[model samples]
Target: MTTENKGAFYTGIYRNLFKENGYSEDDITAKIENTWNRMFHGDDEMRIYSEVGGDLGYMVDTGNIDVRTEGMSYGMMMAVQLDKKEVFDRLWKWTMKYMYMTEGENAGYFAWSCGLDGSKNAYGPAPDGEEYFALALLFASNRWGDGTEEPFNYSKQAKDLLHTVIHKGEKDDGYPMWNPENKLIKFVANCEFSDPSYHLPHFYELFSLWCYPEDSAFWKEAAHASREYLKIACHPETGLAPEYAHYDGTPNHIRGFGHFFSDSYRVAANIGLDYEWFRGSEWEIENANKIQAFFSDKEPEDYRRYTIAGEPFEEKSLHPTGLLATNAMASLAADGPHAKENVELFWNTPLRSGERRYYDNCLYLFALLALSGNFKIWFPKEK
Candidate 1:
């Protein structure tokens, strides 16, 4: 019921971690803006977005030399939360123009990867992208009036996308993004397992209210399913979760993603945001405590792949700065003794400065927006 009547609106009371750690408000805001400008418009080493033909742009995964649904949708989510419609539209345009598939069993789904030149690298859609795209489009429709155009019809696009996500295979070629029986999103349209980091309860809670009436119940069940699903996917003592897991919560090793690594970093950030948005459960508080405790003593540069049970592997983290940012984001809901320590660590860490800066900077900026309360849902003025 929290999502009805425009849903459970954001309170805009973000945790002032910087101020708590002796920073001025102006300083924090300036830092955030500076980071945003640098990430979007700075030199090659600093920026991630590339404007293609006049109206379209793509957020490239600089290190991967390709565009991914992950980065494109993430960029849109960031744009909407920051009230940057231009950036949001550009990314969405490029996605629809190039990555969207219009034929065969995958019609209406986005190809997960594409070359920088706008050619498809794969045909399979990644569910993470669809989830983010739906939520961001809904926010866009509410914030900026839906324009009279194809992709610009924001709410319609959102609703249609959600409809496809749930009913894709009802009488056709494609598969639904979620498992009808379990109500949990799949790692891919055809996969039986899931990525722990893809479970975003906060997003699902809102979807329950905004989605088509016939499927409203499905989204509500999805919210409950993701919350309980995370409880088991994450380790009780360390709060570590596998990058991929079975529906029953055990780590899935089919592709060697069972260890906590790059993708696993989002679990903490998701829990933090879910708690901030809904204040729905006590499990989040405990989960936050356990994860922060698990990494309280490890140096950021030393981050590595680890088993959900807390055993570290020899593999180094591809996105250490990102991992640190999400850990700091976790401080939003964690009332534990080590929470401040984690926030301070994140404050001291600068935006990543190398080839892999794309993903790292994206997560870094989100943490900044979230912790400062700038990442928010916008509403249209009542007529």
Candidate 2:
């Protein structure tokens, strides 16, 4: 709990668990790069990213056969962390050309879904996509500097988007992404519910410093609010959180989302990264520990949808490989008995294959980058 200068922001040291666990640096680097290469440019069965024209690209949600802001924004974050500026720019360009809503109630937000041909499939915004898009854009600006063009003015684009996210409803033009009263992000721009995986205090911590000066304090409060909200959303003993929850932290059962499933897998990963990046909360450590413990005896092949209290359903998990990857990523914060074992299990697991490879492999690479100390915060260049 005594963080002091222990966090990466203060000390610039990201823990390389792979090396500590005796994996050679060469092996670790090869594993990361090879996985990334395959996911981006490999054969039809392996690749998720598809380049269009010369400058635009998109990450397809393979199972759904469509483009999603979730996958696209996630791809951008992955690219920026690995210094793949060209790839980052391509994804951003596609996002703007196809997903950016220019003149509607959702203006300034990206459409959450689109056809593979770059046609809009939905005009409403998903909060998770906007948050990740903003963070990835900010990182791109810091790492590569902003371009003068429309979508390329990275920092400004990020700030402007965030401003709209927080301030949209002030003039009754549209709804804000985060509930202003509680500072918790909504499931979508027009909803009152929240997604536990969407509560990324780690990103908010950085946003508070890098966003427009006038909005700095709100982001700071948001960071704190998300940290506290997680404590309520996640079960005390099991550490499982529903995919969607009410603002008061109870499960929101609308559309059958009030259970632990694919989206809930991210809570553990998010808690791990938040602790590593900022050392923000002791409770995060406990939560990570609890999560790893709960999964310690469970195998990916047998994974299932579950109640937050840990009751399992007969329905198998759609993204079990992704679940293992995230639980392993939880080791970044968890120092419990299961931490090393979870990491070892994840290390030996191969990238998922077949029609559902997109989501699983995305989480897989994220965990790999995180555990290998490759995923990092890109601080802005000094003037």
Question: Over the stretch 1-383, how does candidate 1's per-residue lDDT look in tens digits?
Answer: 33331212555455567788888899898998889888888888889988877889999898898999999999999899888899999999999999999998889999999999999999999999999999999999888879899889998898899989989989998899999999999999987889989999888878878888987999999999999999999998899999999999999987789989988999999998887777657899899999999998899879999999989899999999999999989887799998888888888889987689988888899899878767675555488
In the range 1-383, model 2's lDDT, one tens digit per residue, is 34554788877889999998999999999999999999999999999999999999999999999999999999999999999999999999999999998787888888999999999989998999999999999999999999988879999999998888999979867899998889999998888889999999989988998899998999999999999999999999999999999999999999999999999999999999998898878898999999998887888899999999999999999999999999999999999999999989999999988899999999999999999998899998999
Estimate the TM-score of every prediction. Answer: 0.96, 0.98
Report residue 248 deviation for candidate 2 (angstroms): 0.9
Per-model root-mean-square deviation over C-alphas: 2.5, 1.1
Candidate 2 colliding pairs: none
Once model 1 is optimally superposed onto the true structure by TM-score, how far is the C-alpha of residue 117 displaced, in angstroms?
0.7
Clashing pairs in 1: 3-7
Q: Worst ten-residue run, lDDT, model 2?
A: 1-10
